[model samples]
Target: MVYPEQQLSERQRYYNAKEIAQYYRSRPWVVIWRALTIVWLFARFVLGLKLDEWFNRAELNKFKRAGQLRQILTDLGPTFIKVGQALSTRPDLVRKDFLEELIKLQDQLPPFDNALAFSIIEEELGRTVATMYRQISPDPIAAASLGQVYHAFLTTGEEVAVKVQRPNLLVSIKLDLYLMRWAAGWLSPWLPLNLGHDLTLIVDEFGTKLFEEIDYINEGRNAEKFAKNFRDDPTVKVPLIYWQYTSTRVITLEWIHGLKLTDTERIRAAGLETDAVIKTGVISGLRQLLEHGFFHADPHPGNLFALADGRMAYIDFGMMDQLAQPTKEAIASAVVHLINRDYVELAAIFVELGFLTPDTDIMPIVPAIESVLGEAIGESVGEFNFRTITDKFSELMYDYPFRVPAKFALIIRSLVTQEGLALTLNPNFKIVEVSYPYVARRLLTGESPEMRRRLIDVLFKNGKLRWDRLENMIAIARSDQQFDLLPTAQLGLQYLLSEEGKFLRRQLLLALTEDDRLHTQELQRLWDLVKDDLEPKRLFDVALSSLRVVSTEGIAAILPTANTINSL
Candidate 1:
């Protein structure tokens, strides 16, 4: 099998020899890091850290042992799991067997020091810990690489979990990431080494994203957004954040002590319907991404807790995902096509998303989709292996040259993760089978207005109609539209779809419903604006500004005073 030299082999457009050597010196400590990660796996599993003398005599599945090791790696905390996750996607650069082991890693972790937690709370609240919390826990109930969370009672008697950045976390992470970034850039272009990618680009994205995550203030805003998005449903629990107590490095949210999905035996013992709980978990998460477009990117068993009320609580907003409206629309369309098994349409959707180059034949990727979706098609959502489908997609990058947008990749990860949680509680739980209604509604017709009303029925930062896409709405209303089975962007369909896109987002919000019909005058005005500026953002800016007066506070959020706000 002669493999032709691929595009990845092209000389690093940016990598330099000095930087290459710098990367290895700064970051290759990870070779030792990887070795230690593996050794830790062996100690926890093959060696049986807690196993007794009789344990060696008793036989158990080694595969299960491997899975346990992976869990421990994730529990070991964010850095290792972060590395594992990155490696999980770049199979071309790493060992397949190792990738398999890493894939099992859970993003959940144990809680850390109460003393440190107290310090964080005190610091963020700009007062003594006692002043911030009337009663603080003796120790942290949860801990991750970057933060430790403590359950405490506020002076007002509110039970809360205060998350504090691990001291100097940003400084530590940046040093290591800088090294890795340098190494990937320097080495990724070398033949027999590129491993089919510019490692630097991946590393660079991680740096930017990771740094954003360290800012608890940003994470708090994300949590607030998700909470609002899911407000219609009481079954979901996104603990409210105490914004006043939050800062760049500290966040305080409502305390939730509940069973993680992984506590299977406990869940069973509690007389809870494990299968139902798992399905709810799956649905809630799907609705978060598919419907809300903002989601907690990391949802391992640890981050998701089952409250006494049976609502699933999602924690750790540090790692979150933002889906641009276009990406969300594309995913909705792809999902619809996938349900119908219109492989050709699915293939073309991938191309539209820049996953596949124009010349790359969709024929090859078609079988790949079918091969993965084979057991999934027409099956109830709960009957198919969602994780397997996602893994297959990641595997396809090797066969075809394409760009898997990182945001979409995270969306895929979130889906696979929720599926894993469901499987843990009920092996028979099939995500694909259960997701059929969502697919059927989207592909066959669309979301019932009621469902749409439940969430995103309000105007946002700028009060405007969600999409007063007058021009296209008028076209459709006027019978000038042509229907095509193939996916075509409805310039009108595009705007009215997102809250930020709509002209009367605020009106839709005030009414809490979307009828989406634009009057003739409005359509004519929209058409004139559309003709003036083809850019959606510019058009939105004009409409939004026209709708309301820009306040000084709005400008403040956009251009926060440099000295007052720490430079990220």
Candidate 2:
């Protein structure tokens, strides 16, 4: 259980401390201003008080608050921008204004001089710009807070996009991280909410990723890994990396010319099917999560494209996550439990997934899940909204001893962004309907014996099979891929022939299905075999006498259904 410490070079450690010290020295006012802002916001929103002198009247309005926050983050620079981007995904923590505006928060800034970008590329790659590309665009095709991209063609006639990191990105990011750590420490004592634990973890995770992202070589590796994962998938396209031209500061990738996924009108104008595009996106997302264990953490519209030939292309790979298989299976199980309205199983799943700490009592979590699932289970299949259910469930987590895992947050963000874009393209798009195929396929074909047993538990009641659950599984399986139900049916038939199975089946059908009568002529044949056996009849009578709960309608349903049991 021992963990190894990370090894950092002396220079790196020095710079880390230096940046922290410089942050406070140069920008104490920034920290103070934000601290005051937090206090004012908590008092105004949480406590319902108006501080007329500290804030503008117009900015205090709920509708204007998101814009105000976005402007504040943008003005604060790269570190806060990253913080805002991370906060955008946490609907449980932030208000609607903050969530909406932060989702639209762009990191775009005016491009640095083309000459400086060219010089850096040449310097990083150890070659002149002329030798790297036959022709390279002087103007940047796109510019963001950290880097700028230019279109270029290699001498071999390969068109590519050259991304050059900003000159002082590392230094600026370092200083910003320092400022963030300082601010977090400064605000820790007086914060109204018990967010200190979650806040510290978030900043730590962000810093870990921030350093990883600044290394262009790591980004190249991420793209290559994604490409390897989807090498055979024609629907998903990952940009090819030119490793020979890539370095810590500059990366060269195959240029893709396509419309952004958000541009629904243009995608339609180009004769692309919106439904197919969304389906492909969802399928690819599932494969990354369930099959490969690696996923594109950032799937916003800006990083996705709809190609001319109707394929989906993903660009930025700086943000990616590796989900462990156990977590993935738990998620699949949770989905099935939710669909079946099994609140107890779903509550245990939350504990199993590490959202709840081990040894913590689950009794308290069960009611919250039940309240949400009760409202949800009544809805028809098409009425299911994944985001709405997820948001509601998240709202419940705010008061519980639940920790939001980083990968879980990224998964939510990716789906929310994709779902929003899909709805924009087609108003009637339902995420669960499209995603159900994946979950269903996994449950039926999954390798876990325990999971398979759970499936049987859902299908069986008091050792009697409920044919409807069987039929639903068959239907869901048939919708996506071919399934051979003969084995499952044979297993059920084996149980039907056993002595205990008869009583269980009789009790289950009578108690569960009210009006759905079953034909049970086959039961007469089985009884005819036992009629001659006086000893077995006596045993049955004894067992029947021990029953304390019995319903007349249940017995009536069983009689008719038992007579009608002529087929599997």
Question: Which candidate achieves the best lDDT against the true structure?
Answer: 2
**How many Å off is the CA of 141 in candidate 1?**
1.8
Between which residue pairs do clashes occur in model 2?
518-561, 519-563, 519-564, 519-565, 520-562, 520-563, 520-564, 520-565, 521-563, 521-564
Q: RMSD in angstroms, all models? A: 16.2, 11.5
The residue ranges of model 2 lying beyond 4 angstroms of the native Cα positions read 1-72, 83-108, 179-196, 376-378, 447-467, 481-568
Model 2: per-residue lDDT, tens digit, 1-568? 1112223344542334445566567877865666576556545544322443356554466666566667666655666666666566445457766677776654344578999999988878789999879999989988765688999999999999999988777666665676566666777555443334455555556666667777777788899889999999888889989888887778899999988775778899999999988888888887787778898877766678889888889988887888887777777777777876778778788888866777879897788878876676557655666767766776665566666664576777777767766765676888777777677766665445444455555556555665555556556655653344333333433333334345446555553443465435434543443344336555455445423233444334345556745432
lDDT of 1 by residue, 171-230 (tens): 455445655655566675662422336455556555656766777766777787788888
For model 1, give the 10-residue run with minimal summed lDDT.
1-10
Per-model TM-score, in order, reads: 0.62, 0.72
Kindly report which residue stretches of model 1 are placed more than 4 angstroms away from their true locations once superposed. Answer: 1-77, 81-116, 186-195, 363-383, 443-568
